[model samples]
Target: MWFHGPDKMINVHKMDRTCMALSFLSFDRKQDRRKQSAGAAGRKRFSVDFPFEAFTRDIWIICVSNVVGAFGEGLYFWVFPLYVMSLQADYIQLAIVTSALMGFAALVPIPGGLLADRLDRKKIIILSWTPWIFAPLIYSFAQDWTQLIPGTVCWGVSMLGLPAITAYVISSVGDEKKVTSVLSFVWASYSFSYIFAPAVGTYLATIIGMRSVLQISA
Candidate 1:
């Protein structure tokens, strides 16, 4: 529902272009490897000439991507539970539904970490959105509590990218002193994305109904 603002839409487009540019601009870790070894024959394979250099271009790209996504999510998340209640779901059903999304917090980080180690961290962040693409679609079509499970599960799977995302951000900062503040700033972008989203969502939900908003989010 909140996605309609022309200003916000423009911001999303600009951010996307920025991410593309940043991706091309980022230094290759492999190239760094060659430079390190060429500079010092006896130096360790992973030694750094400049520790702050560990912070990579991908982190900037990620922060931009986060802003775009968090904007849409800020529109949908709180509205969803109220939508379920609108469906006349009972307390137990509500608990189960909420749990369906939360449950993945325990299970996904292992695979997320492995993926972080094995693949391009930027790509991991991008790929994480795939599961979320299905969530709004499922929510659009769901008529009952059981049908909501799939969307929530997809939402959970999207969260699997957190470990990879965190690692990238932390590595990019390359400063222990600044890590916590960096993380807080990154996460707080979600709050910043939608100052008016919940109010807009409530207004839209009242008029067009909740399912329509979910579809818009999708």
Candidate 2:
């Protein structure tokens, strides 16, 4: 986390050491930690397997949270560029707007990682939800393309909590073998929501048009 910013750090040599250090600093469950040491200490699994205890309460919390977040993003993630195009933003303006949103996002991960280490990961995630609350509203009410700058800003700024979300799930359990398994679960959980959410968003778009869909995303 210190070195990787918001990027996954499971590959870093210090990741194990970091995990060990985090385990000591975090909650205790000797029963869980004992299970972690028996298998491969550091290997990433791309697929989810039943042998891994991947459906625990904490994991579900992350899954559910990811679903809700993904669902919200899904409503607009695909339609956003189209919506901006509807605003008639020229290529140059669109490029600038996209850059503004993405540029801020890149800066957030560094602070996000630092905050993940210093603060409660759950709380950080909870706080991160605040931007989504208003971001859609900003999009819904914006009368002109320029007004969307703030809306895009909120979406981009939300990247600040990404590291905390990733770190929270990996560090939730002390086992290294389980880390990759949990990572797979987390990826699946967040991704699975997209399968349904986009369809739902499309349905709603037919009923209310794109701008109102942004409001519902809130």
Q: Best TM-score goes to which candidate?
A: 2
Instruction: Give stretches of model 2 more than 4 Å off.
Output: 1-48, 51-55
Evaluated against the true structure, the overall lDDT of model 1 is 0.76
Task: Give the alpha-carbon lDDT of every model.
Answer: 0.76, 0.78
| TM-scores, one per candidate | 0.67, 0.72
Top lDDT model: 2
Clashing pairs in 2: none
Q: Pairing residues by index, what is the TM-score of model 1? A: 0.67
How well is each residue in 83-136 modelled by candidate 2, as lDDT tens digits?
Answer: 777787888888877888889888977998999999999888878878867888
**For model 2, what is the alpha-carbon lDDT of residue 33?**
79
**Clashing pairs for predicted structure model 1, backbone only:** 55-172
Number of backbone collisions per candidate, in order? Answer: 1, 0
Candidate 2 backbone overlaps, count = 0
- Model 2 per-residue lDDT at 104: 83
